[model samples]
Target: MDQVVTQKPHELLAETLSTKMAAVNTLIQTRMASEHAPRIPEVTAHLVNAGGKRLRPMLTLAAAKLCGYAGEDDVKLAATVEFIHTATLLHDDVVDESGQRRGRPTANLLWDNKSSVLVGDYLFSRSFQLMVETGSLQVLDILANASATIAEGEVLQMTAASDLKTDESIYLQVVRGKTAALFSAATQVGGVIAEASDTQVQALYDYGDALGIAFQIADDLLDYQGDAKTTGKNVGDDFRERKLTLPVIKAVAQATDEERAFWTRTIEKGRQEDGDLEQALALMAKYQTLEATRADALVWAAKAKDALNVLPETAIRTMLVDLADYVVARLH
Candidate 1:
């Protein structure tokens, strides 16, 4: 007998789009270089080279190719998408006071918060420059609005994450702003640059939005039950950090008076003690919130797949559908 292996959907997409991805990578490198500041590239390269999936840029490429685009603008948009994403990560690590990213020490830890923030600003400038080169006002507008939405989402989370009053609706709004906005923008701009039909572009945006929501929901759920080694995050890191994710929000909704008190102390008041993580897991299990969260993720994944009905049947499209499934498949 012979052992068999299968490449993940993302891996398959990367293989199919290797040439364009290479161009995106080259453009990213060329644009990240600074004449006066040597530290900018050093900091930017740290996170960009970290073992990220580069899924957002790939989404841009796939959407453009699926729409029959045959120009270099897709590559530019892909690089632009990546720069925006990288810049967000740099800023997020600073905002969260995070010490690690992608299983490695974060740039803020490697250098300083000032360096990370300045480099992130540099990347945002670079991303805008790349988008401007494409000469499409629609593309520029979409990305610019997404950049603002991302900032607003972060601020919302800053206020909402520790509040017991946060609900599912607020959580979804934050998700849309922080995660889905960029995903949808990345896909939508690809179609815009390719001059895709309005219907087709909307479909791409819907797919990316649903996929991003499912991706974030799944990530939040994993923080409660996921394997530390596999997830690169210790179980209940969100709980420990006092962040009110979906599972916790759902659990809080169904909590008893005593449970609510516990939540207030641990989450709202940030007075965690030993075994608090276990207690949080116990509450989630008691309410079956993790299962409910998983169900929600599956629904979004289905919506993502359904959004592709308007898209042409292509290999890239198939990979995208599978990619949506793969985003929630980790829950199993």
Candidate 2:
């Protein structure tokens, strides 16, 4: 027999699941439309049309496939996950007052904040409708809790954003709420919908939870380290916004008194000046916080890979392990 070579994890996942993803796209379009308020669809479409990796939805599909699911509800669940994710992005851009997303103007910029917020609410409602269609109370409970947890994470982040007293434990909680909740829910629902064993469901949840933390950490590190073209974001965007991500948190923990004042002025007080970014980078380098942050990301990525051990060995599992590796590989 001729050997079959698998492509990269994401690409292979996309190819393997292309047919289902197409169904998901169709469902997204059909559900997002609003005849009464056409502007709703217009605002929703702007962000939805903008290119995203759709990793959450793909995780749902991959989990279902890996667990030997043979039904169509995975499509609805995947769409539900994407809707939840898109609604968050729309709301996040409004909350952040951001103008750019996925290398294009945010919906709030093109339309208005009011439009963005209302449309985001609409999508949230639509996601619930789709979730209901799955006819699984466990799936509903998981996704609903994830929605609340995501909101809690964002709220916690707002409170913790510039507080110098915020520590790694709080930071981890914030990361889990904001990023990992939906990831774990996505995978967990996939397994639940597939009727997978309890152990497999737990394994999927563990994998997603760890992968999300690592992914967010790498993203935070890249804000200080990545090029604009590569990261789809300008360097120091986090610093400019006064957001206290992991790298900044690590630097703050080790700051000298003078450096603490500098962080206070620049981060807490939003008093950044011409050389503030350079100085921030200098301090992070001095404390090796960026490297420390990368190490943390690697650890989480390893946990995600380890979580896959209980599952049956298959191509999807290999891809998932590679996906975890790729998340940390961003530091390279």
Candidate 3:
């Protein structure tokens, strides 16, 4: 008997959208190339070829198809979305001083930071070029605003990540800026290109926003309890990096004076000692903050699913709803 393989939601979406994704990949390669600067392609390819889910670009394609689009502009916008996402990863790795990404060495590590930053800027320019080719002022406006929001979020994180006063509201703002902005824009642009009704476009935006929030919250939660090999990150990396993730922020909110001192010394003062990770885990366990964070993620995932009620029921829509669940399901 043949063995049956169970496909994940993203895998299913990829299979369904394989042809469009191929075009997007081709465009990405053609645009990433630079005649004068060979290093640009090298650095860009290093990160681009790395095993990523391609979820953001896929969202664009899916939204376009869902809105009954027949034109080729969806492909261009899909490629644009991907370029923007890849550029952000390159810059983010440098900002975080990260050694690994997507279970591989980061581009900044393989090449120099200068190479990474310059190549990232090159990709951003390429993304704009692709978007301009679409000739839609609305699409350009959406993506441009998303780019600005991403930068603003990064700057906010720089100031807020180590600060003890970073609360849930501030954290939500950062998540929306750094993560959800692109997601919502990707979907929103898809609808815009298809000339979808204003209501449908808003629905797509809402779905993407909630899904992105769920995705990030799940990622932050995983940093505390996930398998390092699976997640491509060591457990407690967020704690070690002094990032004020949702779980840590929740724990800080409920901390006693002694626990507050621990957060102050480790996160605020950057004086993480040996066994501190264990103590941090113990504190989170004591407060059940991880569980609380997981609950929040689930809530967002639910909202993402609910947002799809406005769209027509189809396989793509179902997959998108399932994709939202799968992001948080990693916790299980």
Q: Candidates 1 and 2: which is better by TM-score?
A: 1
lDDT of 3 at 154: 95
TM-score (all chains, Cα) for each model: 0.98, 0.97, 0.98
Model 2 per-residue lDDT tens digits across residues 1-332: 12225455677778778999999999999999888999988888887888777899999999999999999999999999999999999899999999999899999999999988999999999999999998999999999999999999999999998899999999999999989999999999999999999999999999999999999999999999998998899999999999999999999998989999999999999988999999999999999999999999999999999998998899888888988988888799
Query: Candidate 1: lDDT of 207?
Result: 95
Which pairs clash (backbone N, Cα, C closer than 3 Å) in model 3? none
Across 1-332, the per-residue lDDT of candidate 1 in tens digits comes to 12112778999999999999999999999999999999999999999899799999999999999999999999999999999999999999999999987789999999999999999999999999999999999999999999999999999999999999999999999999999999999999988888999999999999999999999999998888889888889888898889999999999999999999999999999999999988888898898999999999999999999999998999899999999999999999
Candidate 3 TM-score, true structure as reference: 0.98
Task: Tell me which residue pairs clash in candidate 1.
Answer: none
Q: Quick one: RMSD of model 3?
A: 1.4
Model 1 stretches with alpha carbons more than 4 Å out: 1-5
- Candidate 1 residue-pair clash tally: 0
| Full-model lDDT for every candidate | 0.94, 0.93, 0.94
Question: How many Å off is the CA of 154 in candidate 1?
Answer: 0.3
